[model samples]
Target: MPRPLWAGAISFGLVTIPVKIVSATEDHDVHFHRVHLADMGRVRTRKVCELDGEVVPQDESGKGYEIAKDQTVPVTDEELEKMPLPTAKAIEIAAFVDADTIDAVRISDSHYLAADGQVAAKPYTLLRKALERSSKVAVAKFAWHGRERLGLLRIREGAIVLHSMKWPDEVRDPQGLAPKVVEVGEEEIEQGLQLADRMTIENLSGFRAEYREVLEDIIAAKADGKPLPSPDEGGERKSGEVVDLMAALNASVKAAKESRGEDHGEEATVHEMRPAKRTGGRTAPAKKKTASSKTAAAKKTTARSTLAAKKRAGTKTAAKKRSAS
Candidate 1:
């Protein structure tokens, strides 16, 4: 079992469930250290005192808050620990709310809340089952790292998981970050929805960090003094601006369906562009063919046919006279 990072009790009204916080996730990313290129010597950072120009030991360093220029208030860990905070040693439940009500941006880290002892098992299971049945998450307050933090308690796989959350004030408002308003056709929106449906999956278990695997391979090759592996030849990266939005959406939908091995029944229909006038000015409505113009064209065709027939008769009469003579 993973070692617990913190030991605490959940103060759920009158019930107190002792629990241990263990990391719910793990990192598999490859880490690198700085080294000198000439001799491969490892480079390290040393903490130094700014005023005395002396290297400071880890134990000698303490937290300080800067109030003004060159003025700081030093704070010790003992002082912070002794502060009057109700959630100093326990996760005090504030309220229960629907899980969807909490914004995703406020959620930060996650940890598993395991029962600390046999006595805690009953209450832990009670809370887990209650949350599972009610389908609501518990919002709690806990003190960690010298400050009070907001947390969400929810059930996952019959175990209670605590997700650290940011305070409302800590989250920034996206006031002007949205794109400017633009016109979009109904067909384009429908195509976008179709693309989303095509790409939807049941869960995220199939995904893996392919970049990390390739990085590990590169490191192993370097350590074994072997040639680095060449990259696979894939399709060329698409570049340039998208001139036609509807066409792009149709292509995206088709690509997604093909990737998922779905049936390609029919092609996406695009809106037909209206015919416009070809002039050195603003586009005008296309001219319609009138009945008078059609009648005039028919008369010209008849006159041409009659002239051709008369010439043919005259040529035949001249040939007959020459033969008689």
Candidate 2:
């Protein structure tokens, strides 16, 4: 069973509904060991005071904000309770807006909002189902813990999903990060897009936390008193044994065709391009399919050329040997 991160009451005008907020996400990133070089010992640091250079007790510590240099603005626990922000109990529904109104950069966290009391079930379910059916979301303001957060309330998976959002001023402009580029012609653009379409794949499933799995398996093997396989036991794989370029591309295109029920025989050259723009009643792109096809349709043209050269050399040598005989 999942645990609720927070338990509170949601308020919208006259309606007060008690709800528990549960986290909707988990992470499994690889964790690393902390080690030291000296005597091969692990290095660790203690949280200590900067000036006094001494470890502070957890109970005696208080929060502080540094507006300038190392000078911290000390805040007591009681003082923070009376601070200017609204009390962290109420969720104020400001408006109902389109679910698409919130952008990726604005989203901070996701949460599952579940009703607490049986009396509030009807209204809560009504709101949740209504949002789910209408394809709309509610914009709300919430003071959670000690911080103020702008949030969106939408129905996801038969339950209410309250997603925290960033204020408009907090979202940075994309123009600063992305630079302008020159546009290509429609024909060339289409070819580039088609080539890019060739490289797409399905959702990530084959990929796994390799190190984590290896560690876990090794641990299990040790616990069961079984001999562990050497990590590098499978020696280096030969280049010839791995999937060849042509075979891999063929398999990928075949799999894609099977899934999408598409049989893309060959890539469209410049002449075969759509929109059919022609000059002098003749296609310039059509003339180019290809002017160099006999020599260029190869996975490794250079390697083939080298092999052909070697074969010619052998033939010439055999001919010379026969003449001498």
Q: Which candidate tops lDDT? A: 1
lDDT of 1 at 281: 48
> Each prediction's Cα lDDT score?
0.80, 0.68
Per-residue CA lDDT of model 1 for 39-129, tens digit only, reads: 9999999999989999999999999999999999999999999999999999999999998999999999999999999999999989998
Error of 2 at 61 (Å): 0.9
> What are the runs in model 2 whose C-alpha is more than 4 Å off?
37-42, 67-71, 82-87, 191-325
TM-scores of the models, in the given order?
0.79, 0.62
Model 1 global lDDT (CA atoms, 0 to 1): 0.80
RMSD after CA superposition, every candidate: 30.2, 21.0
lDDT of 2: 0.68
Model 2, 223-263: lDDT tens digits are 55867646656686576686644444445555544444344
Clash pairs detected, candidate 1: none
